[model samples]
Target: MYRIFIKPTLILAAIAFAASFALSHVNKITRGKIEERARQQKEDALKAVLPPYLGYTIVEKNRKATVEGIEFFYSIAQKNEGEKILKAYVFECENPGYSGIVRSIVAVDEKLTLLGMSVIQQAETPGLGARSKEMASNKTFFEVFFGLSRKAASDKEAVSQSWFEAQFTGLDAGKKIGIIKKGEWSAENAALRQELIDHNAVSAITGATITTKAVILSIEKGIAALKHVLEQENNAPGEAASP
Candidate 1:
């Protein structure tokens, strides 16, 4: 009985230990690559969301602050021209979505005007909530299906800006932004897109209102935290307030 039972138990234990060790080794080997990919994704998101200027510098890199017990990370970008300097603040925000957390990078100016937003991470359902990160392709279905436009597409530089994210550009971040259930946005429909922008609203992804709201709510909370931090900084002794 000891040989049959105890020996099998020991064998199983050894297998489990070996598996765990192998997994640890694999993780160690790939950890740096994973981190590097994540960093690149964040850097791309920051560039996509930041307000356009002739050229800009990252004045503050990965600054951290806590407001009301919630920690926030942000970066400041500056563009200087002659005697004037323009600045933009980019904040990373995450909120629970239908399937998982939706993380985004949002940029705003000194007057609380939203410059842009880019969804950096999300696990929402495909063809629905996942469309939040989908870009409106300029190619027609036939061109894509037949690979007729491959050369043209490859020649042109790819842009990460998505229709859902583009709606947030030039919005009033200090106030509530609205969402409407008017079909998905199309890049070719300039009139309809402009109409949505004029109303300070974004067209919600079909059948994914929860994910849409999650992104908006995250941005709002992040802006609030940033406002608190800025206010504190401005009030600090000998600190010049942001203009």
Candidate 2:
């Protein structure tokens, strides 16, 4: 009885060991492939999000700040001919939304004016929080007047809801951004308009107030983190601000 039981247990153990070994081997092989694909996709994403221009070279850099374990990836846009500076950047910030962290990247000129930005990563609720990436309006923000002149009312509608991240273009990072619900069509409230006009305000996503706030907070943090670099570049005695 002892001999029979011992042999059966040994056989079972050997089979289990062999199965685990096979799985580990498969995992290692697949992991390498997955990593390679991820790297390629990241490179593509970084390239796509940059300010669109021809003959500019991107120089990538990663930096970790002492505060809040913030890590950012940045790129310098350099001209091809004389290697002149086209645009400068101070890149990413991770801010917590209702569901999880929202990671964003910014592109700025020498004056630290926000030029372009991309939401590179996010982990949030599907319909509500995720709408941060969408435009406030899928159609024209405000429609064009008489098929000729463009008015602010119609222009507002043109902004992409799916690309809500692009709304930050041309914002001055010096001022704090307040989140508001008012848009071009609705202006009954004077105080909100005053607040928006007085302060650099961003219109929040409908039903996604938390996500909108998260985005604003992330940008604020990003600006804070980039303060030193911006000051050094913009305040240099002999430096001329980029147009």
Q: Point to the candidate with the largest lDDT.
A: 1
Candidate 1 lDDT over residue span 1-243, tens digit each: 989999999999999999999999999999999999998988788778874452767899889998999899988888877898977788899999999999999988888888889999999999999999877766777987898887656533466778889888888889888898887776678887888778877888889999999999999899999999999888887686544
Candidate 2 lDDT (Cα, 0 to 1): 0.64
Clashes of each: 0, 17
Tens-digit lDDT string for candidate 2 (103-212): 87776665666665666678778877776664343234244434444455565554422445655666676677767775432234456545654566666766788887
Model 1 RMSD in angstroms = 2.7
lDDT of each: 0.86, 0.64
After superposing candidate 1 on the true structure, give the runs of residues whose Cα lies further than 4 Å from its correct spot: 51-54, 152-157, 240-243
TM-score of 1: 0.88
Model 2 lDDT at residue 12: 95
